[model samples]
Target chain A: MNNPGMTEVLFSLILVAIAIAISRFWKINVEKDIAIGSVRSFVQLVAVGYALNFIFDLESVWLILVTLLVMALVGAQAASSRVTKIKSPFVLILFSILFGSFVTIGIMAFLNIITFEARYIIPLGGMIIGNSMNASALSMNRITSDISSNRLTVETALSLGKSWRESSALYFRDAVTTGMISILNSMKTVGLVALPGAMTGMILAGADPLDAVLLQIIVMYMILMAVAVTSVVVVELTVRQLFTVHHQLK
Target chain B: MGSPSLVVSHVSKIVDDKKILEDISYTFYPKNIYTILGPSGSGKSSLLRLLNRLDESSSGEIIFDGQTIDSYVVCELRKKIGYLFQTPYLFEKTVKDNFLFADNTVSNSQMLELLAQVHLSQKMLESSVEKLSVGEKQRVAFARMLLTKPKILLLDEPTSALDPSITEAFEQFIQKITIKENLTTIIVTHSPEQAMRFDQTGILIADGKIAESSDIKSLLENPQSDAGKRYKARELS
Candidate 1:
């Protein structure tokens, strides 16, 4: 399969033009956003492509790790910006996403399911970190909202001699489930509803359909594990912050 | 009636640089019922919250059973000094679940006995808490609290939702249990008549300070402080 040239890349702008045209027709006032978003994504992806080419050629493990950390930091910052209830949620979010992604990817490398090469680790690690970041943010938001709104329920349990963990256990479970619901639904209708990005990309790049399907399955399971671990870790850390050592809700 | 079961010595609670309670000092005795009467936002509930360490005090200390409340394990302290909110929050499920929530080791027989004391029927245990009336929920909450065998009971407008008949009967039940179980009962109420019903020691607080602390008869009948007189005349809350 031949790599796409500049002509093919320029042809994709027609889709953006159509989107802008629809926005104009509807008077949605989003034509500027669509134009800016298209330009920004093009620039970002081109930069990333060049950076990845450099790192792949160098094949330095330290450089790869630093790149991953930078990605995780960016993801954490993006996630934390969405959360308003808690103070300084960045450290906890970063820890959760890093731990979840590292553990899942490390296990796959250990099992030789994926090698520790730059090509495999960078892309796979990107997927793990990206998924884990969303899970962490979703769970953190869910637990904080749940606890604040249900002060009576939590304090009632506390006043009845239950510890902080016991008082907020229901909200903890709910937050974890909320974080996981998207991936769970994706798993249910992965192939039937729409082709997932990994598989579609592989198939589009001339890989065999069966091989693409197998890779997509692995990606699905990897995302599930990463999301589960990240969400649980985030909820655990968040709930601890909601209460004091004296078993009182903060 | 006995040595002090709980003591609030020079306690104050300041929130966001605003004083909610200030230099509050009081001694609570065992087997005695104390009515905490004040207008809305008078810090009556805040004072009770301090006793159980629900909210930290800005200054002063709370002593329960001869030890500072902080000295004991916090969960243990809360268990001993049980608090019931203005509207009883029953955990979703059957009535028995709430009992088990308080003290899982409580036997069915013990639960039945406590229910009888609170005038709840045996069949009510299997019923969902949502089906029970507000008065019944209060009793369930009260009985569940007793399962912990608290030395002190803090009731925050426990009967505000109940009708007159249930309020009178519940007040009697609280008084009877205070004597029978030797629990030091501190009830926060808005109505002066409710304080009169308790017919015991009364603490009248206004603007975060205790305006009157005396027998129930003198507090409502012949209040000495201006705050108490204003409270009596329904001019201040």
Candidate 2:
């Protein structure tokens, strides 16, 4: 029999080689980061493979809860690092992801469209958490930069008897608009330019073509709600800290 | 009715283990243009910011119009005191939008009149702020600041980045606005010649403290100390 796994490994190696060559030609210092990230990804995926096998077998609700808790903590850490100067970024991340992902997951589960089993729960949770993390990071970074750069304008608004929220409305609008654009664009091109991961995974798992398409539709809808809600809410909360109690931007 | 236009009492600021200002006490009356003349890093800008409460004083108090600055809301205080930076910080929008900012109250006629006062035409309003020359941007910024109808104006080297002709135009505009509006103005500048133009009262700061406070021409003519002599040399040079 042909070693198909060997083909996958060889393909990955070639991709790495091409990445290195491009980096060298462009004088990019991403070589060390790429090497370390690849190694870490390998180790993490292997470890998670074993852990997930055990988790799937147990079929306990508590186990699923712990897994989601771990995901939240990791997502919070990632989001916080991107918007560093603000204190309590973890709180904003936690609130955003928990509200966004859980709401999406809850609605889908309640509809009985996707099974409440480990097989569906873990993957869906991962997708929701990952997308929400990206949205939160983008919105937070944009809002922070916006507030700092448009400081004079913000102060001008404040002087005009506007509240902090009113003063920062323009920035809040810009940041959330920027964060949602990617999701919106992907939505615009869905099923035309790209077959997203959920759809591809469902298809490879021997699911019917129509069934896979339906699941992908649900997942896309959930992602839209999660990304939009998470980005807007997180930015609103995080920007409150940029101002003093006296309504002044420090 | 008896309240002074602005009052700063015993204000001090310490940052990074360095004292920027210490026990600064002063009263500024209405309809007068005051110039803060100081060598670089002498905390003149810090003191000016203290009037509007932009920079917090570590100790002591600032009172404006018989009320403690701490008592007035920060936003309200800032609205009453307009601040203009050395470099024109125009937004990435049309000149008209930059003037209006988030303020919907400023009407088209008011903006046009303001532009005309600064020698800019209505045709320039629709142009992007980034496309304007530095002097034009400064004029736009000044017009924008005045739109709020601030009772006091704080200008930090308004013409520092301008060419001689533009600086002369800016100075003339300054004279017109201060006289017309009867606005209490505090200007921070390094040039003695420029300071003499609108400086009805002068305060010289050196080594993080006020070295002299007198009439602008008097301060220029009679050198009081080594610091004053240094400023005089700059003027002569």
Candidate 3:
């Protein structure tokens, strides 16, 4: 289980070469994307590897917090970009991902389930933020569209003396359910249908198979809880955008 | 004898710099049918929305039963002042479920009575709302409105979907309920004949203003204002 050195890594270029060659033969026209993607992945991962090495060496709490904040900002922007209809998705997305990622990390660190070190926090924070980002974006988009398209239903409920919360309750539920479906499906099919990234990465990095399974379980639970929080927060903030204070549809 | 059931005082609605309703004032008394006759864009629906606080007015106040509308909780205000839209929206569930949506504690016998009042069979309660025809859905919506025991009812073209025959029967059923329940009913309609047939107060709205208000017959026979005259002319021709 020796680590793959520079030669082996450069040899992986052949795989990308084969993909580009096939695309060229078929005239599929994605050769540029394939080539750029291969080069981009190599650069990004190598840069991250060096940066993480420095952060892990430092072990400064402030440095970890700063890194998490930067990740949160980028994650929020990426999440907000997916929701086109919302008025201003930045604050909602930022707070949601931050809340979901840090809250889970905070609880884990408090209980000593995961250490406060850079190696554990950074990777785990990335997982939590990544899941929450997807969940927030998806839930926000679904809730906004559902409430807008079901204007008649929402208004009818409002007219029936139902509060705005009660009026959009169904859509909120549907949106959150949609956001968490990925996590739920992954949870159900874990270890059977697929070996997830964290688990596979752990195994490839020479961790014991049992240890990888244990870490994967923790990651899955962390993702589920984070996604749930993100979905709920985004739905709350996004649904309010669709109505006036007077309970009228915006 | 007492204060009117509902009052819209100097209410105006503006959205996105466009005036939807302006400087409209009216008092709706109990146990009377007030037909709000207007052109397509005359703010009939907007006015109805403001009454129950579904949409707030940009200026002015609405007093419901001697208390301002905003003073009451919004949900309770809507229950006290029910609204039925032109194209009724029923939750995609059984008729019984739709009824329960308004007041979950509604008794089965009360539902039966309300349906009977709207000329609907009690057996339809078990059936899903999707199975009902448009006319049936309209009647069910009417029945649902009654379930709240609202003192004021705002209807925006409730019969717009029904055929001539169903509309005729609906008119009769609605007139009966207005008198029997003593509900202050504000109905918006395109047809002047329905307004006249109801034989009650008529308010002619044009360009978001009340052009004229009087007994239905007098207003129909002799409208004095320019907008009223125009509406009468169009109705006749």
Candidate 4:
């Protein structure tokens, strides 16, 4: 069978309709979410498709960089919104995601791991940016909540003349650990637990199993590095938000 | 009174346009155990917090050791004027970790000595703080704060966590440590009994101001101002 065209994709939406109908029958309350999500994803993916096609055809480094920068800005905005407490965290989140994506992808290109083609860079950059986004948000959330709750511990350390960094060290460590825990768990139980998304997708799309496996390995490592860098950046910025230069909790 | 160690000059703390502490001034002497007595919400804790620069005053100055507190580097100042919270928090892990956290250079003998000052056993060094009783945790926190050899100690209702017997002993230990180390000790307590037990200077804080400053017995038994007299009535009952 041929890969589903937009018409086939539209026909496939019957599955979502069926799910929505079942939710209605059971009064599961998530029918609104499912319906909105289906519509939003359709619109978003369609826009991304057009944008990527245009960027790829141009094949200009400036054009690709602009697109990646835009994506990083959006990713950062999304991640910062998820972090509940912090005064105006957009700049921090943007810098974290941008640094994580560009540095990793830039290294790969410089090392001749992947050519600087829009085809390769855009999708891979998107993956890195996406993973880093979640890690940054989750980590920031964890550390902020931890510090707010453990005010006495932090203030006690500060009262002992500990520097701000030294005072929040415990919370900082826990946040970074939490941010990277998902990737670490995946690394630990990847092939044994279940086939990962990338490998499965490649196999479904008729690629060689060994080739898919090799690509999956690279993808996992890239994600690991991106997540690690993002986690550090988020925690570094976040802990600063929680304490003043005078070593007092804010 | 011992030599003057800290001078609070016209200090007032206003938060949200309300007076937390209003035009309060006091001089603290080294080796003197000063007990700050006040009703709940009388800004007794607020006054102690201002001494260590934990919270800033809306208007006024605190002179620690003849210099304005703001002139000193904050971390260094805090080290010298250690503030032990009402409910002490120990860093998780061994009691040794708590001491080392305060001063990494503290030797085993020093740790034992410091713990002994707080009436803790030397065997408590390896004991995890999580496993310790609330009273034990407070003692350990007090010992840890002392590791840096602070010149002043701010205890915020310190004996609140301890049993009655432990509290009396701890109070005695505090009196001993204050004289032996010549530390400027400020304790904010709800108990008039504790204030009398310390027997240094008693300052009655009423409505964000010092209503009376006298010996604990006189302040409690023969209070001066109307506010002081009312506080005396409540305490006696």
Candidate 5:
């Protein structure tokens, strides 16, 4: 398949046009949103493509690390904004995403599954950070809502001479499970349901079918591990803030 | 009496610039049942919470056993000061689980004994708490709290969900344990009749201050403070 230039990209806007047409015809009141979203997505992707081109050309290890840090910060901000109970969840979210993503990446490098080059690290780091961000957000949100809604349950345990950790142990399991549920479901229905992004992109880029499948499998496991670690870390940090040093609910 | 097992010196709690408790001072003696009587939202529960350090006082000192409550490890302090909620909460599953949750060292024999004290049968221990009546659950919660071997017990409207018979029985059970275990038992009740039934020293809280503190009969009949007179006249509720 020949790599079509700007014309193909422009032609894709026809699909966006059709979406806007339908939204307007049905009086969904989302035609403006769809149009704006389409334009935003186009601009963001194009900008990312150019940036990646420049970074790949530079091939600086420090530059790659800086990019990952920036991505994690941006991802953390997006996750923390979704949670309203906690006053400032940004630092914990950032730490969780960084810890979860880098730890997996570190292990992958140690096992020689991937190299330290910009090509491999940046893309895989992006995937890891993105998934971990979602997991952290989901876990934090679930635990907060669970604890707040079930104050009697939590306080009962506390009044029974239990520590904060013991009082909320059940909630931790629930919230972490909630965080990991998506990945678990996706893992179960991976190829059977639909082609995931990484594998589909690899195949479209003319990689061998088996190679794409192998990479996709690695990506799936990486996400599962990252999500697990991130959710647990974020939930632990978040729950600590909900109680005082005296073990009282705040 | 008995060197004041617990003492609160000028305790006050302010949340969001609203006073929940103000300059509350009290001395709790061991082996005595003290009833805290108040109307709804009068900070009866808030007073109990401060004793157990479930909620911190804004400006005050709580001395437990000759030392400030802050001196003891929080978990150990909580263990020593057991609390029972108004709507009794039992962990899902058997009554035995609830007992074990309070104190993992609780034995089957001990569980059975506490259950018996609460007027529950041994068979009920194995039964799920969800299937038990509200009164039964309150008794189970009472038994479980006793399992911790606390030095003090804070009962927050513990019999609110019980019938007349059960409430009487539960009150008698509480009286028995306070004497038997030498526990400083503090019970919070909104009803003046319940306080009279206890026939103990009563602390009347009205608008976050101690309205009266004396023998329940004297406090109810020959009242002193304005709030106490209003309470006797059936006006504060």
Candidate 6:
């Protein structure tokens, strides 16, 4: 079977044209960003393509470790950008993504559900870290806005002899719950309503349907675990810094 | 066994190179109403916030009871000194929730009785506080303050947003709460008439300084400083 390279290029051009038309109709200041992001995405994907080709050939444990570290660092940087008020936010993001991805990957490897190999490790680690990064960013942003906007409410509670944790409990709960919504929505729509990329890719590569389904289930469970642990831990740690030792909002 | 309710020793506050309050010293005793009369931007609000350590002074000490203000935990200090804003910023909750802010465990009957003390209807409790009139909200704020049973009440133009009749009612409510609760009250108001209604001891602040500190009648009747004379003429006019 022949790959339709020209058809793919024509489809990409049509999508770009549509995006530009929509932006103009909506009067959105998105032209420059869209152009820049498109170029950057192409460059990034080409670089990743070459890197993955080489990475697949190496088959070394150290190379895999290095690739995972780079991914985690990029995830941390992305998460930190969403929360500028928080000093040392990179530390929180680093720990969250690292711990979340490692734990998920470790459990799968230990269970022998997925062989400890480059193809599985790289893609699985990337998915876990990416989802955890997003969850942490969402939780932190919500928590920061909630604390600053409702300073009086928190202070009022604190004055009434409520502990810092007790005072900001509602805000913390709201942030975590907000972050969890995406995961919950995906869970609701998975398998029946939509086929995820991993499952579809495995099926396309001539893998058995049952094996592909099992892998998808494991990946979904790992994503949920990663998001939950990262969001809760990061939010709890960062919230403590918002209050002073005197129980005043900082 | 306790010292005066509040004592400020040579307190000075500077923000962004401008002096808001400079070298202010005074003592407030328990069960007395002390009114700080000043024009807009005269640091009247800043002075009130200082007492509760909401706004820190650049120098000098604020001693509440026997301990220095800095010695007490800010949250604990704020609990003891209830600070009410010019505009009643009621939460997005029922009137009952507003009072329950200080202590949620209080019985509904106790809250209703307290509301009655402030001349508020019991029906107001179940309604949304956002829907209340300015006067009604001010009264609810007073009721809310009473829940904490604060040792001192610092009011920054509590009736500023009300109409004439509502202002008069608010004044009466202040009088009732001060006497009934035995609260040491420091009220900051621009209205000389309201200041005179509250207490005799009045401190007039002008150009970020205390121009006069005396009885309300003395300050109003026998103006001494140029600022005081000008203030008196304006009030009379």
Displacement of residue A69 (Cα, Å) in model 6 is 3.1
Arrange candidates by DockQ, descending: 1, 5, 3, 4, 2, 6
- Which regions of candidate 2 fall more than 4 Å away from where they truly are? A1-60, A81-88, A110-117, A146-170, B162-173, B235-237
Q: Is candidate 2 or candidate 5 better by DockQ?
A: 5
Of the two candidates 3 and 5, the one with more favorable DockQ, higher being better, is 5
In candidate 4, which residue ranges exceed 4 Å CA deviation? B1-3, B235-237
Across residues B1-237, which tens digit of lDDT does each residue of candidate 5 receive? 769999999999999999999999999999999999878899999999999889999999999999999999988888899999999889989999998898888789988988888888888989988899998998899888887789999998888889997789888988888998888999998877888888999999999999989999999899999999998888988
All candidates' TM-scores? 0.98, 0.84, 0.96, 0.94, 0.98, 0.82
Per residue, candidate 2 scores C-alpha lDDT tens digits across B98-216 of 77773568788888888898878889989988789888887888888787778899998988878887788878778777778878889999888888877578888887777788899
lDDT of 5: 0.91
What tens-digit string does per-residue lDDT give for candidate 4 at A1-250? 5777989998989999999999999999889999999999999999999988998899999998998899888898998888778888888888988888888998889999889999989988888998898899999899999989988888899899988898888888899999899989999998899998889988889999999899889989999999999999988988988776666777
For every candidate, what is the interface RMSD in angstroms?
A: 0.6, 3.2, 1.1, 0.9, 0.7, 3.3
Report how far off residue A4 is in candidate 1 (Å).
1.2
* lDDT of each residue in B18-116, candidate 1, tens digit only: 999999999999889999988889899989888898889989989999999989999988989999998888997999999999999989998888888
**TM-score of the candidate numbered 5?**
0.98
After superposition, candidate 1 runs with Cα above 4 Å error: none
lDDT of 1 at A85: 97
- Report the TM-score for the A-chain of model 2: 0.86
> Candidate 4's residue-wise lDDT over B57-84, tens digit each?
8889999988999999998999999999
Candidate 1 collision pairs: none
TM-score attained by model 4 = 0.94
Question: Fraction of true inter-chain Cα contacts (below 8 Å) kept per model?
Answer: 0.73, 0.34, 0.85, 0.78, 0.73, 0.24
| Cα-based lDDT at residue B112, candidate 6 | 84
Score each candidate by Cα lDDT.
Answer: 0.91, 0.81, 0.89, 0.89, 0.91, 0.82
